[model samples]
Target: MKQRPWINVIATEPEEIINTIDKCPSGAIRYSIPEGSKIKENVSNGVGNINFENTNLSVVKIKVNANGPLLIEGPTIIIDFEGKPLKEGSKMALCRCGLSGNRHFCDGAHSKQSWKPDQIDK
Candidate 1:
């Protein structure tokens, strides 16, 4: 299988999703959309019909917390260093801080450490 480039999108609407994902050089392991929303390719672009199958969008979605773990909202295949598959859930928290006892996964260690990183909105 050909390796695809990892793409990160933070869009809420279909138009926004198309615009953002269109910018990626290649598709990613997952494509993130807002919770309770799905990207519909049938939506018209005013000028013409947009073809989603020709696009690089994927079904995987993730939500980034302002001060916490990344809320991955689907089952994503994660491989360990030894090329073994690790069990992931439909909804899981990935560590944002560098102190997770589980390494990549959040172990709620950030709360104990009281680590708050700077926000981009600020």
Candidate 2:
């Protein structure tokens, strides 16, 4: 099987991320695999922020850990659902376990919950 490329976008503006996905090519696809579900492909979302890529600003890099929060690096600004900026930092672990006391931010609940992703064999 061919290895699929992964993309991880970390940005202050979630709209920018969504816009890039929405503008993907014809065959370009995105997936939001549940933590316990089987992973059919070795893929994540776009690896870089489209907004930064288009400008002179720094790009935010991210890693989608299986069954965990998104590992992020570089200067990033996080926004809430209402288009309000929530936080800004150089590194962060955004929640994916849905058990965080602080929503959208990882609070180490995955470790306590013993969460693990259903990974595909290489």
Candidate 3:
């Protein structure tokens, strides 16, 4: 009946369901629903959106841990050793372990490497 409106008159099923699985021609499956369609017209803003309700922006702060990655909190930017932007425009933990596969960014390498700070006599 979904295929043809005219066929519905002759259908025997008490109820009808017209479920559609749209597939693009290129082969990338349309698994995720488009945001615009699902979002309500007057819906309130949410977290992780680039545009924030609180326009007052601020720099994030970090605690230099005695040993291990810098425990960064609040808003900040991060870059990798290759000069590639890594997790920019946000707050994140940074590796001081020197063994991070991502380089300059913490891939949790401190745990595997067992990094500990050695205080030097200044």
Clashing pairs in 2: 7-45, 7-46, 7-47, 8-46, 8-47, 12-77
Give the poorly placed runs of model 3, Cα more than 4 Å off. 1-57, 79-87, 118-122
lDDT of 3 by residue, 71-121 (tens): 564555566678776665333456676777766656555655443543321
Rank list by TM-score: 2, 1, 3
lDDT of 2 by residue, 1-122 (tens): 12334344453344454455544331123335345644332232332222222233377778786666787766777898899998765556787767878778876566666545323212
- Scanning candidate 2 in windows of ten residues, the lowest lDDT window is 45-54
The local distance difference test score of each candidate is 0.50, 0.54, 0.43
Q: What is the TM-score of each candidate against the true structure?
A: 0.45, 0.46, 0.43
TM-score of 3: 0.43
Across residues 2-116, which tens digit of lDDT does each residue of candidate 1 receive? 2233333432555655555444321222243444555453433221122223233246678766666776644456678999987543445677777777878876566665546
lDDT at position 39, candidate 3: 40
Q: How many Å off is the CA of 90 in candidate 3?
A: 1.8
By lDDT, the candidates rank as: 2, 1, 3
Residue 79 local lDDT, model 3: 61
Give stretches of model 2 more than 4 Å off: 1-57, 117-122
Clashing pairs in 3: none
